[model samples]
Target chain A: AQSVTQLDSQVPVFEEAPVELRCNYSSSVSVYLFWYVQYPNQGLQLLLKYLSGSTLVKGINGFEAEFNKSQTSFHLRKPSVHISDTAEYFCAVTHMNTGFQKLVFGTGTRLLVSP
Target chain B: DVKVTQSSRYLVKRTGEKVFLECVQDMDHENMFWYRQDPGLGLRLIYFSYDVKMKEKGDIPEGYSVSREKKERFSLILESASTNQTSMYLCASRSGLAGGLYEQYFGPGTRLTVT
Candidate 1:
């Protein structure tokens, strides 16, 4: 079975500061990794994904994640965060299977950006 | 833009009531999914459909059921709504072709409150 683990339940940071939300996954087969963000009262929006590419993946809203196969981790990072960037972030993983049947998600990390 | 719309934004129901949450995707995608998002637990899949009249159970489907009579629409049914079942329900769709490299489009989400 595949599973994802988010290290932090919440991360509080000041505006314009750098932040990282750590995620780790365990799967028997090769996997596709993803980051998703959910704002208040809104559904999740894709932040980024790593299918078969370079280790570093860039995403919308100046967010990025590094897919470290050696460590079995995909950690989301932002050089500078804004107040608007405060949201809940989720890490998800699915095996590299054809037709994609399942996606396992970790408990989210709530990012709280303050001025 | 790919659009996934839910039937309601907010709903309140008493326990033991039969509840139906609807979702429709404008994109001619082949797969649709239903998930529930909680504060720290993130999004947990309840059910998914790959085609019309075909459904599959996800990781958490004990209190939920689903229907996909048509390609573009999927409905989540709760036979007996309970307090523990109150959550933010999200609907997502993705193309089944090309090995699902494309991101899943999400609805705004329905916040269900069970009493």
Candidate 2:
């Protein structure tokens, strides 16, 4: 079974400060990695995804993530966060060869960005 | 742009009531999914459908069922509402092409509260 793990439950940061949300996954076979952000009372929006090419993936809103094959980790990062970036971020993984896209998601990390 | 829409943004139901959550996608994607989001639990897939009249159970599917009668619509059913079932419900759809972006587009989400 594919599983995703996000170590931090919450991370507090001030405006203009950099932030990193760590994610790790356990899967025997190759998997697709994704980052999603959920704003208050809304659904999740895809941030970035790492499929087969270049491990360094850049996503919307100046967000990016690196897929480390050896470490089995995909970590999201932002050089400088804004107050509007405060939201719950999730890391997800899915089997690469499956026709059905059943994503296994992490528990989530709440990014608390304050001014 | 693909658009996934849920039937309700917020719902209040009493325990034991039968609940129906509907999701529709504008794009003709072949895969649809239902997920529930809870604090510290992120999003856990309850069910997914790869085609009409086809459904598959996810990580958690004890009290839930799903329907897909049309190519663009998927419905989730809660047999009997319970307090434990109260949470933000999200619906997502993805393309089934062999090698596509395969990113799931999500709806605005339905916040269901069972009393």
**Against the unseen true structure, what C-alpha lDDT does each candidate score?**
0.91, 0.92
TM-score of each: 0.96, 0.96
Off by over 4 Å in 1: A98-100
Q: Which lDDT tens digits does candidate 1 get at residues B12-93?
A: 9999999999999999999999999887788899999988999998889998999999999999999999999989999999
Which tens-of-lDDT digit does each residue in B2-110 have in candidate 2?
9999999999999999999999999999989999988889888899888899999998999999999999999999999999999999999998786335888999999
lDDT of 2 at B93: 92
Q: Write the per-residue lDDT of candidate 2 for residues A21-56, one digit (tens) a residue.
A: 999999887888999998987788899999888999
Error of 2 at A104 (Å): 0.6
Clashes of each: 0, 0
Mark the 10 consecutive residues where model 2 chain B has the least summed lDDT. B95-104
Worst 10 residues of 1 chain A by lDDT: A94-103
Measured against the true two-chain complex, the DockQ scores of the candidates, in the order shown, are 0.71, 0.65
Predicted structure with the largest DockQ when compared to the true one:
1
Question: How is the predicted docking of candidate 2 categorized under the CAPRI scheme?
Answer: medium
